[model samples]
Target: MAKILIILDERTLYLYQNNQVVRSFPVAIGKASTPTPTGNFSIINKLKNPYNKALGTRWMQFTHRMHGIHGNNQPSSIGKAISNGCVRMYNKDAEFLYDRVSIGTPVEIRQNRRTDSKNKSGYSYYTVKTGDTLYQIAKKFNTTVEKIIAINPNIKNKNTIYPGQQIKIPD
Candidate 1:
């Protein structure tokens, strides 16, 4: 059976199969005022291209009727916390996950406070500039692209970054 883990602090959803991580996708979670609920639940229903265009192309309803994991029309919001409690993903990512998982798939949403910018190695934060990619940042920091992505789970597209976005750099 497949299991889904949503790390709210990292803004990343991980798909697990037989205790191995099969896939990971960046997600947009709820804002501070309206935080996404952190609990264990199961997918109760699946909807393809629901009437709500704002929900992108797929909707995977959780045990809670009001909140579910769904796709969003706004691609730029994929790595931001601006949703109304429901975890949001890019349309393509949402479709990919929807197609793989079925109703009753266990979903666990939890907060990972350890992902905070601070680390024992003493990390530095960098503000993304135009034309910046994870590769460039990793090269500049003498680290690997995977390391950068590991620290900044909010970065959905490592190749696509915008100016003013902040990411962490491991020393």
Candidate 2:
């Protein structure tokens, strides 16, 4: 059996077959303000090239009829938190996934906090988005950039961050 697992925090979609992950694809998820619901779900409807170009070439409606995993017209948005509660993938990736999965396939969406074996301070995680800056994030969370670095020792260059990159934020 094939199954889908979406880890919102990591912005990844995993394809599983026979209990093993066969493939993984980066995906864009709902923004922080409109986070994707976390729960067990199943693919319900599959549509190819729907009327909306924003949906790209494939649309798989799951537990929530309004929210589906679909192809994205904005390629750069993939792997970022920019969707309106839907999972967005590269057009080709969506097509690839669409060809393999069927309606009613089990889909599980959840958020997992990343923890490095060396450090586990339980700080909040934020997925970097387009035009995001370390200073901006620090200000948004009302913390100092130095504090963020203290919690996330892995961030060597506070000057550089790409969209979809996950970083820890102090609470």
Candidate 3:
């Protein structure tokens, strides 16, 4: 079974299975002015690197939002509070999750209050798809393969991404 976790505190999301981490990526959360609606959400639909311009939403700094993780052909300030409320990921990460998780997968978005985990590493989850690997996912997330393994003790090797597999990403 596929399990999805949306961490509102850290502004990250995770996908897991059998206690194994699958995939993770950086996400843009809602602004302080407008908070992301909390509750369980299902994968209502899927889009491959959707366009914000098509939605009539202007980019923060770029001419357009392209690429994975909500990037557009136009360059813009990405690493900050910009999105209205939707969680924005790299075009690649979003595309990956869009393909792996089905329309009915439960997406739990909640406030995170655990402030004292001994392991303060920023953890994220990535869902595997065809032609995915630890190296590719890590590079796409601006992370490393070793860090990915560190977060996920279950993945013994780097070349192990079967569709639906969840890999943990460590920061």
Candidate 4:
């Protein structure tokens, strides 16, 4: 299996195969104060032509919706620090990574130390919209309401989602 390394501190991503670095790309991490989260993760899911909601003043519980490594609908944003939290890549590059990765592949995200989290997995961030429900979002993503609730432990109840809530979708 191919290994992917995301170094948030260096603002670079490396894809490795058979023990050699196959490709590398520059990334725009969260601002200095808002450092990108560091941990071992996996691609739990995939999406295409993803739409991103800009980060605003509000504490978006459902912010980062439309967040995933997907084909860019707006190709112009590549190599820019534009996404609220999601990793934005060029359309062709994202598509290439998507094709090479699977649901259970391991992903290591590090800022200071290396990660050891194994098992292929993925995640997504969704912003709640008007008249939205956990169940509806789950169905749309082919996931379950319980799963969504599990990922976002802060949510007290499935029925309490408000518009502009940023929920994490786990695979």
Candidate 5:
């Protein structure tokens, strides 16, 4: 079975086979009041044409009770935080995922609070680690330190970054 990693902040679901990302799709997450649960889970159920208008053409239920990755009638909401508590996908994307993943496929939903750096423009976030320098981080992210600093004005000292400090990585 394949592995699924869903990043809530990134609004993305990554399908992994052999530890490599095979597919990725933008997804809509839960609203602020009913945030998506985070943890390792498994696809416990799969249903085609779930018969619910809100659920759309497919449903891939996870271990989280009443919370699954499903298709939505509102295709425009695919990358927003507007669902009740489930992950919402386009019908075609949902069908594609349903066909590729099995009932026992592992699923991981995570909210990276430390680096809650995702934005509407498809930017990502990264956290500073011990022994990590701006030069190294820039190279790792394929960006430059100047760009990083320009976006993050709160960073007073470019040379000194504490562990766990969240920084923006521009697209």
Candidate 6:
């Protein structure tokens, strides 16, 4: 089965096939003032070349009809948080995803948060608790190993993680 896993904090949308990530694309999520909804959802409807300019080449509404994953005119916004609560992708990427996904495909949106007063990387920090494995932590935060490693340069070796080691967790 196919599924969509969207990590809102990381500004990435991934296409999962048979429980593994097959593809990912940068996305623009909702701004701080207007946060994107996070939860388990499914694609409910799809349209091509919607009448609205804000929804560029494609549109795919999920659980909520008011917001959706869509392309926009501003390609520069793809990796930034500037949308009005919807997920925004570049037109070509949007089309690529739209063509591969269908109505009823599952979508899971996640945004994890943590803070350390000493940190200034603009990313959340997770203090590894006893018995915490990277796999468990990643699953706990609804993130993937690749996403975790992308921000934490310190984690050069996945198997070397130990308890109490504070690591950067991409929000």
TM-score of each: 0.65, 0.66, 0.49, 0.49, 0.65, 0.65
The residue pairs in collision within model 2 are none
Q: Residues 55-154, candidate 4, lDDT per residue (tens digit)? A: 2111111123433344445556655655555555555676567667776566665542222232255664655655677887788667898888877888
Segments of candidate 2 deviating more than 4 angstroms: 113-171
TM-score of 5: 0.65
Off by over 4 Å in 5: 113-171
lDDT of 5 by residue, 100-156 (tens): 999989987766644433478655677565567788778756788898888887887
How much lDDT does candidate 3 score?
0.54
Per-residue accuracy of model 2 over 1-171 as CA lDDT, tens digit each? 999999887899999989899899999998866667555689999999999999999999985548899998899998798888899999999999999899889997756644211135556666676567789778756789899888777787787677777787765
Q: What's the CA error at residue 166 for candidate 1, in Å?
A: 24
Cα deviation of 119 in candidate 1 (Å)? 21
Q: For candidate 2, what is the total of clashing residue pairs?
A: 0
Model 5, residue pairs in steric clash: none
Task: Specify the highest-lDDT model's number.
Answer: 2
Per-candidate alpha-carbon RMSD to the true structure: 12.6, 8.3, 15.7, 11.1, 11.0, 11.6
lDDT tens readout by residue for model 3, 5-72:
66666667677665556976566665655445444456554444236453222221111222112333
Which lDDT tens digits does candidate 6 get at residues 1-171? 889888876889999888888899999998755667665689999999999988999999985547799999999888898988899999998999998889999988766433413246555666564466678778856888888888888888668687657777765
lDDT of each: 0.81, 0.82, 0.54, 0.57, 0.81, 0.80
lDDT of 2 at 30: 85
Model 4 off-target regions past 4 Å?
32-35, 50-67, 71-77, 112-171
Which residue pairs show collisions in model 1?
none
Off by over 4 Å in 6: 113-171
Please report how far candidate 4 places residue 28 from its true position, in Å. 2.9
What is the TM-score (0 to 1) of candidate 3?
0.49
Global local distance difference test of model 6: 0.80
